[model samples]
Target: MCGIAGILRVHPLGSEVPPPDVAIPESWLDVLDESIKHRGPDGQGRFRDRATRPDGSVVDVAFVHRRLAIIDLACGQQPMVSERGPYPEKPRNGRVAVVFNGCIYNHRELRKELQSAGHKFVTDHSDTEVLIHGWREWGLEIHRHLDGMYAFSIWDHASAGIYSAVDLVGEKPLYTFSDWPRHTLCAFASTIPALARFQRAFGITPRADTHPMGFSDLLAYGFLSDDGSLGYTPIELVRRVSPRSPIGIFATRGSVRPEPCNPDPARLPAFSVRNSESPEAINAGNVEDILNRAVESRLRSDVPTGCFLSGGIDSSLMSILAKKLIGELQTFCVRMPRLEYDESPIAGLVAKHIGSVHQTLDCHGDPSGDVIQLIRQLGLPFGDSSLLPTHWVSRAARDAIGVAISGDGGDELFGGYERYRAAQLLQRFASFLRMVPSMTRYRRREKSRMTRIGRLVQAAKEGGYPALLMIFPPSELRQLASFPGRKPWEDDPRGDSVSQAMRFDILNYLPGDLLTKVDTASMAVALEVRAPFLATEIVRRSMMTPVSALMPHGERKGLLKAVARKYLPDEIVDRPKMGFSIPIGEWFRTDYGGMKQLLLDTLNSADPFPEDILGIRINRTFIARMVEDHMDRRRDHSQRLYMLLVLAIWSDWLRGLSGTIRN
Candidate 1:
């Protein structure tokens, strides 16, 4: 894993100076490098080149890389360059240079293939070298052959152009900035803060619009839109490199324009069943075979590796498979001080059953500190409560291992969430509810029972299962905001209601929330997390299976449980699903005094809460009432209140940073 940044200059026609004449100072690159040193602590490298195209247009590119040294610890230094020209032994200017973040599980296979094709590798063994050579061999098509989490940028010296791509699932992040008017710089980095600092230091004018639609989406859906075609970010000038998309920038007419490569539909995992078997005919062995291969592939790391065993079916299954494939696995689990929140005992049972070494870390302290640290590391507002425990587990695991395998995608893939069942139940009973007479009165008793049921019935009719999973309902959001109601983006139409919900999550929630949470939390501690469940093979198979097969007889993740029963005891396989969660609701009532004080202070402060920040005038009275209701036990508003708090904190942080930079 690593952090990469680069600057490219494009000089338009009739310009007084060519791009090569404009020098980007080494100190500026140093500043960019230092801004993200936390992402990679092992070492650093910098590369600079100025190339003149056939048309006499000049392009200057500088690349900086911070290394984490997961593989080829001694020789994996990068901004790695590929060997070039006929005399392989003699040193020459590299044809392609690359700085990559994230592991390539299939690098060994690719390496052997490249070697057989007459490509020579100079490193002892480094995936970075394989990627550079692969680029030389396959060009941008190299991204399709790679099977791992990655975000990379390659500078092709011969073409005077740059190529960049993020992984299929967006497990890693990349952000880009362009200052067209000044003609001074165009750059990309791993974080928004790095770009912000770069723009400030270089005096690049900030873009006029900050993309208010993004903030509107955040308020409506707890995350930015997954539609990467739209430029969405807190800063209008910066844009994210969309998942599974490649971007190219070439010096054309003495200027550069970023061209997004057309997405190859083949890159998407295509669902299929083996030998055209019916869903019922598919058995545990089929699922087990795919999962085992996925787990084995992620176990490819030079450093010591481990698994996060939450005692939930997903993580437990992953741990069991890792142990079976690689003996004596090291497993880590977080033990919350509260009994209701802790799963260490169950995890211990699984560890003992597998005969693996296990350790448990305690997460019992003031959460305010961790919340602040997480927000700072995230560089955005993410309201997932599990981030607290995920952060702790990553920190503990990093002390013992540089890489850890996780079971993040299992829930979305296998229908493991309670909401899936709830949606199904709503759909199943909607007809019965419709037959009952509507409640005509507005009394408290009527509102408590029939009114809520009516709303559910209406939601079912409208096929709003995705909205049912939201923290704040559209009605509530509209009351809090100035704008009219806006629905969240929908996924491509699927046949069944359950499959629609699953596809919705696979596109939005999985990438936007779950994957984002894991990446930010794990990388915050410099630990690489590989999700075996997210392997393309496993995901395609899971998605192909009918929802009824995945959750037979109202059992969530029924297919997964059936497979786990082969390797695990019945108790572990049959236990209720317990998510990795914090006791934030209870804490609001009893503990978390400091957090409460902070929220109250922010709400009561003299500084106006900018309506543009949330794209609505927030009802302060309603927010204050939510706090009181949670404290008084009149209502459990923890989730909604927490989301609001995160938005407020992130907004304040961004404002303060902007003020500091301007001063």
Candidate 2:
């Protein structure tokens, strides 16, 4: 984990190597770097360099790196550069430098492959060095060859340009602020707060619609969509260069020209893709090897690293492997007071079997008082109930370890989600009944008597499908006048509600919210959390497997179970996956009077959205009742009320951003 920043001037911004005049604002760097200090703590680097053109033109670049010392602890440093290559005699002069966050699990294999191809490596030093040369050897197409979560930038002096890319899943965040006019460009630690200092230093009213405002957009879709508006801050400026898309920043006369190196993902050499249905014939024996390699790659850091054990197959399997690979591993588990919710015993069993030092933190208190503090700490409004627990575990982990491995991506990759199994069952039913006559007829009918009757029959056949199966129903959503975009469940193409919801969650909720929650919360304390299951190689391989293979007989994560049983006990294997759930509903109802009153009062100030559209008064009542019921142990309205509370919080956050950006 590190901090990276660079500035490319279309024309001359400064001259001389390490251009002093073009130095990135110290105040701005302080703000951004400090915000992301959780990502790196051992050391930090700020490099500002420039080239002088024959016509006295200048192109300046500033690269900021905060090091967390993984891999070659003694020598690995950034911004790392490649040694002389076959064609580029002076590779240093070749001008390619990279400041990267996240690990490249397959770097060793890639290194060997590059070595076989005649690319020389001098550093027995860092995984980052491998990245520098890998980009040089493979160009923009190198992304597909790599596995693991990452966001990195490579400045190529050889091409007089800068290229950057994020992981296919957007796992590792990359945000940029580019103003071609001033030849000013900066990439920072995390979201808005890191850039807050820049806003203050430059007096540039930070773009709210992009930064913090992006939080509300997240509320709409449960995460940031592939093509939705960025966030509230100008920080949303880093448009994805696309996974395989290579961007070239050229210093032209009056403007910096950035052209896409449009590389086809399909054509990449090291590419491997898998789906839920079944593993591709081509990717057989690939998933296990790739996953192991991903885990090993993450182990390359210089600092001590551990794993978050949950006794579930995913984390259990990861713990076993981590114990085997990293000597004297530390495993941290979170235990809730609810007996059903606790996994400490299972986690402890695994730790003992694997000979790892284990610590379990009890989550037995209230976070209602911390809500405001968290909102402010995050510099945005986010609704994940898991965030607080994640915060707890992260703080605990930071005390004992610098890096902790998580099994977060297992469900998304291996058909581990129960919802996906439900989708599979529904899809099968739909497939089996495809020949029905009235169902086909219903497709052509609209609102006539026959149509209404036929549609009713169709709905019955489809199991009472909603327009969208969101946490918040669209009927309720219609009331929030400021809600952006279409209905969350209004898919571009219709399918099973379960599958649609799953896809939606993977695309938005997973990266935009879940990963963000873990990344920010953990990094806030400088704890590096690596998700080995998220290795793109494994994800692609898993994607290729028949979805049925992932969830045979509608079993959640059947593949993971099979894998887990190899090392985990039968008792542990059969245990229900409680997931990272919290008691937010109970808190909101019984203990959070201030929050309830504050939300209702805040919402009442906004009038454009009438009660009819939002069912505001009724929804509030529903929320209060839901919380009350949950507190009374009457029912589990937890998920529903939590979503409402999130919406309320986000609504307030969005309202606050209106004047800051061109909403």
Candidate 3:
């Protein structure tokens, strides 16, 4: 895994100089590279070159790569260049060059296939090389032949056009800044700040529209925008390369647009649709087969790897399956000091059964200071509190391994969440719930699961399932801060209610919230975490199972449990899903380990946020009241306060970056 950054087709669009020949100075890459060094600590490389197009406009392409050395230790250095792929018919502007992040699990197979096609490789086992050859052979079709988590850009000196793509699941992120004329791609990077720093280097004007999608979107859904982009105030422009965009033209641009290369996800694959006990039995073997291949492919890393065992079905299954395949494996879990949040005992039980090396890293210390640092690492502002523990466990694993296998996709891929069931339950009572919108207006209860579900049902009246997952309701968001409400979420119209909720999470929440948390936390310490359950085949097959079969008799992830029964005892498979979480809510009331104090320090810092950013003018009085209420043990405002704290610190961090850039 690595952090990749580059500037291409940087003409006179944002620069002061009138262009026919102006190009971004290579020094700009240094600033971009420095922002994400933690993503790749093994080594760093830089590639820069200029091509004068026939029209006399000079197109400059520069790529910077930071390597973590997982696949080809000696020769996997990038900004890797190939002499030339054999297929380009046009005048070659330069060699085929690439900067890649994430593993290519099927690189060997691809390499052998390419070699048989008479494509020669220079590196012994560099997965990066396969991409160069694959591009030569497949062109835009390259995404179909490979499987693994990746975000990559190919600077085709051959086509003088750039091709970039994020993996099907978006496990790796590529953000592009495109404000140049004719959709010219100017800057792209693994993070927003890198591209922002590059934009600043050119003296481009900044946007006053910091919360273009409005800050309430961040509060309600944790993101300011939808699938293709984040609500980033474009120093030039910032759009995350999701599976939505297709590869497009060049002005020094690399489109990390994921093509529809994977199996058609438009129609959920059909299942047997038989009576109970039939589809589950039929799919269990298929799931096991596809999942086994996924796990085994991930284990092919050159560096030592371990599993993040939470003792939940996802991790337990992942750990046990990995152990069964490899004979012995190292498994790690974070043991929270808080009993309710701890699952290390159950993890130990699974580890003992699997006969793997088990280690429990204590996650007891105050993260007051650590969290501030962690948020700064996020390319965009993310409100997930679990990122702290995820980072802690990743940091713990980093001491022992380069790659950590995780059970991240199971919940989203299979129907493992109560929310899916809640949506159905709420849908039945939607008419009843809407009648009491007046009561829900004053009912701000969020303590018990019942109350939380109540709030969810209440909120769903305004929007849909997306609203059910909202942190701040529209009225509350408006009352507490001046941030406006986002566009109402329209429910997916295609599938059954349960299936639609699952699909919503797979497409939205998994990528927007969970994966962002995992990618940011893991890569913050330069550790690579792979989720086998999200493999293309597994997603396609799991989505095929009817929600009824997947959750027989009202059990969440029931189909997954049946599969686990093949290897684990009822004790492990039947246990409750103890998510990786922290007691930050309780911590806020007690200011446990100075968390309350730390928040105050940031919030009270003289104008920490731009006067305009904190909801035009932050309702300081309302914020202070909530802090007082929570600290005094009156209400459980932990979730709202934590989200506020993250936004405040991240907003301040962005402000600092902007100040430095302008200066």
Candidate whose TM-score is highest = 3
What value does the lDDT take at residue 111 in candidate 3? 92
State the lDDT at 317 in candidate 3.
90
lDDT of each: 0.74, 0.59, 0.73
Selected candidate, larger lDDT, 1 vs 2: 1
The 10-residue segment with the lowest total lDDT in model 1? 438-447
Residues 1-663 of candidate 3: C-alpha lDDT, one tens digit per residue: 899987776343334433323455556777888976889999999887665454444567788999888998998999899876554563432378999999999898889999998787999999999998888887777887778889898887645557777776678877777655444446778877677666667665433344535445666666533444232332336666765443433653322222223232332343333233544332655767777899999888888999999999999899988987888799999998689989999999989888989999998645897778877776455777898899899988999999999999898877888777677866667777766644442334454665665676666666767777777777667776555666655545455678777777777788778888898888888999999987766766676666776787878988789888988899888887767778888776567778878888876777655654333666777888887876766666777888888877776766676663311
- Cα lDDT tens digits for candidate 1, 182-243: 54467988877778778766775333233434665566556654765324666657777877
Which residues of candidate 1, in runs, are more than 4 Å off?
18-22, 83-94, 180-184, 204-212, 229-231, 269-283, 425-463, 488-494, 552-554, 611-616, 660-663
Worst 10 residues of 3 by lDDT: 253-262
RMSD of each: 4.2, 7.5, 4.0
Candidate 2 TM-score to native: 0.77
**Each model's TM-score, in the order given?**
0.89, 0.77, 0.90
Off by more than 4 A, model 2: 12-24, 52-57, 81-86, 89-93, 115-122, 180-189, 210-217, 228-248, 257-291, 325-328, 352-355, 364-378, 424-469, 482-506, 592-663
